[model samples]
Target: MAEEDTARHRARMQRKKAVIEERIARASLERGVFLLHTGSGKGKSSAAFGVLARALGHGMNAVVVQFVKSRSDTGEEAFFRRHPAVRWYVMGEGFTWETQDPARDAAAARAAWETARAALTDPGVALVILDELTYAFKYHWLDLEEALAVFRARPFHQHLIVTGRAAPAALVEAADTVTEMGLVKHAFQAGVKAMPGIEW
Candidate 1:
């Protein structure tokens, strides 16, 4: 009876492999994607950086523009900054609540957007990660229409990833791939503070 079950499982696996191969052969589209990662949960920016690492592994040039985080203590930022192909910019004055000045926050957002726009227009940049950029739009620090225009005008072969919570409806519609990280449970709720190499 066990031998019969094993044989059946082998047959099923073979059939699944054939179907997957057929689907792979049929897929011919090759183009850059606009990906958005957003939610109240964690790992949105971490996921974007994972893609950045993948691009770097493939010898592609990438740029990261941080909008609302001014700290330089992140492990990813520290590691990626050493690579010549990665252009990293942290343009935020700080979080909105920390800055407590609408005019100053808006100015920082505009400056970050300008840097991001340059990366988008550069043909050599294969991947552009706009870290926490949605906060700029959500807080009205940057114009949504202007941001969309830059995304639309980016090079045809350059991929863009935007990561933050409370992504705008327009951005969700514009993205080719959107992942919303839903909150289930968090360590912070249990009074566990964020640790390095995990939350950073």
Candidate 2:
């Protein structure tokens, strides 16, 4: 009876090992080089930051440029600014609705895009995070043609993460991986105020 039990266990183990190996093989063949538009949910920028953390943990060079809501008070921005491996740049603009100035917003976005473009071309930078970049495109503050050019011309192995709501179709098509975070529920809708570390 013990021998039969041992044989059964060994068979199950072999089958599990085969399944694992198959998954690994399939994953190894998948290579992605493009944008990640994480919008439609509140965690879009947060997810991008998660990727930045992973890149920094691995000793890879990373750049984060926050476009809208560029306050330095955010916990993530505060922590990352002190890290030697990360280059952080803030466009330093309040929310678009708050600003109520189209010309100023466009100028700010252009400046931020210039910084991002430089980061994208830098061979030392393995990852570039463009936080709230989609808003610039959506508002027509940044030229879409030039933006697409930069992405296409980025060095091989370099990855970009763009976060904001309502990502354009062209940007989506250009991406190798696209994740749309749908809004299932939000506490803000219930008149609950945003708290630091959770909403900010």
Top-scoring candidate (TM-score): 1
User: lDDT per residue, candidate 2, 39-148, as tens digits?
Assistant: 56778888888888988888988899988876878889888889898999989478978899999999999999899999989988899999888899899999887898
lDDT of 1 by residue, 1-200 (tens): 69999999999999999999999999888888999999998899999999998999999999999998998998999999999999999999888889999899899999999999999999889999999999998889889998899899999999999999999999999999999999999999999998999987
Candidate 2 overall lDDT versus native: 0.86
Clashes of 1: 0
lDDT of 2 at 138: 90
Per-model clash counts, in order, read: 0, 0
> Ten residues in a row with the worst lDDT in model 2?
28-37
**RMSD in angstroms between candidate 2 and the native structure over all alpha carbons:** 3.6
